[model samples]
Target chain A: MTGQEPPKNPHGDDGPNPPDTGMGMTAVAYLLSGMLVWGGIGWLVDHWVGTRGIFAGLGAVLGMAGGVYLIVRRLGA
Target chain B: MAVQSMVLADVPFPPSVEDFYLPSILPWGEHDNYWFTKITALVWLSAALIIIFFLVAYRKPQLVPSKRQWLAESLYGFVRNNIAIEMIGPAGVRFAPYLTTLFTFILLNNFWGIVPLIQISPNSHIAFPAFLAVISYVMFIWVGIRHHGFVKYFKNSLIPPAPWFILPLLIPIEFFSNFLVRPFSLAVRLFANMFAGHMLLLVFTLGGFAMLNANAWFLPFSIVSWAMTIALTFLEFLVICLQAYVFTVLTASYVQGALADEH
Candidate 1:
């Protein structure tokens, strides 16, 4: 995110280029996880409530919050 | 009296899908259906067009490079250096071929959705997106387990270090979300957007036609519907490109994650 970019990592003895995403893989991973959380909750809620609209509305709010929380926690660590 | 009054009735312009439905084009015979019925032909045609453009533009492959060569090189360079290297690191160079092929394929198929007459996107078909997602799903999972043993990879994905109490809740969520939900969401996101977008366009475009043919009074509303249909067409182009990029970016990210240290 900074204007200053880090030098690229050197290749490992095993082959070439280490397995890091520079920003770390967590950014992308968290986004995917967030989507999954929203989708899963929506699906489950729809099944239980027998209403698609209510399921999506509530599910999105809860899913996004959970997703952000998990991502921040991971990043902080 | 009923017939005259019915003509003026507010039949909220019929949906767009009916106007552009396959029915209109279906009667055109084998030549017409060739582009629409088979998905791969559209993809192949798109890819062929790209290849021809590049080849024609850069036949000399000059060191200084002409404008066309520059454009071609820039595309290859952007995908190669920016997306692939950024996602998979320098080691990703080895996989550049696969990544390039994917980016080109998806980008072309997506563009098909807005290509005027040949307006259907191959990715709109659930089967195609599902196939791509499955490949990515298998690729990452296979790489993860192959590099680290199966038990270790599964443990790595599920049991990232956390407070002991939190682990209980996180484990099930992480396992299901990553293993079960990842592929499904990946497929559905692209599928749902294209499906819905195409349906909307169909409703507006087709409904307008159906209404227009019905009566003179119906023409004005049909015209408004057609305008909206055209706007949605433009929006659809953006969605197609964005979805393709998202799919590829997410794939690269997943692959990167598999290669990273598990925590």
Candidate 2:
């Protein structure tokens, strides 16, 4: 052992991608919550507007896009 | 099939969720009583055991080592080094005590799921995990607010680095994901695992009896079912440890997220 002070948090490790950072769960959470929140909101909008499932479908797709965007922004960069 | 009906006469073929709601202890089957139960007893026992064990283990001071002291130290070191500091950075040292306590409490509680007669985890109930999750949730938020102040902390987490045009879309997503999902998932993940583990064991153990009770021809299959139950117990052991470790690591990760500067 070098007897030096241990490296700091996961980022301090030598590996390019540290493991078990809990970011994976965070990513999944973003994706799922994104779809649920926007889609549910769209469904309510549809209910009020008296439209069919079109808005809900659009919302799910848009939310999923936002989720990917968030993952890329937060975890990727 | 010639068999003594009284041996396992009341063995319900397919175990149900009712089995988990063990009868009350305080009132002794008086019905409409929920003050004390086996689950409550196990939880209290686990807490007391940890408190006493740690107190006694570190009570004696030795430079070289004693077995109990060494064991206690190892547990603390693992959580501090591997979980707290590893996940939360240098500032995590302050949280090692809480993380270690959490790890041991969950480990012991989950262990009860497969322990011979004490075959039910207090965590199988949603209330216990929900409360634990609340503590973690409140802690990270408090830490974040204390570190960055209330407004800045909310800005730090709720507002992502994105083009201003799309911020309206992104901010809601961030709030829902970070604030709402984190605690809900934390509680559900642990409770479901323990609950399902108990249910799985109950099914196999009772399936054996159910098969034997059905007909003599199924006796061999019943033996195999019991054998599978034994193997699954070992698997349960692995799950118990993994779930405990996962919970601690995630809580530390949340704290780290709270303390992060930019990214």
Chain A alone, TM-score for each of the models? 0.51, 0.76
State the TM-score of candidate 1 restricted to chain B.
Answer: 0.78
Clashing residue pair totals per candidate (backbone < 3 A): 10, 0
DockQ of predicted candidate 2: 0.43
lDDT of 2 by residue, A1-77 (tens): 11224454345322333466898999999999889989989999999999998889989889999999999998894
Interface RMSD of 1: 7.6
lDDT string, candidate 2, B1-263, tens digits: 23566666668869988888888999897555668999999999999999999999889858866888888888988898888777876678899899999999999999999999899999999999999999999999999999999999999999999899989888889999999999999999999999999999999999998887788689999999999999999999999999999999999988888888766
Give the Å shift of residue A8 in candidate 2. 7.4
lDDT of 1 by residue, B155-245 (tens): 8788757778656545655666677766887899888887788778777876776676577689899999889989999898888877877
Off by over 4 Å in 1: A1-69, B1-36, B47-60, B66-68
Give the 10-residue window scoring lowest on summed lDDT in candidate 1 chain A.
A1-10
The TM-score of candidate 2 is 0.95
Give the per-residue Cα lDDT of candidate 1 at B53.
Answer: 84
Q: What Cα-based lDDT does every candidate model obtain?
A: 0.68, 0.88
lDDT, residue B169, model 1: 44
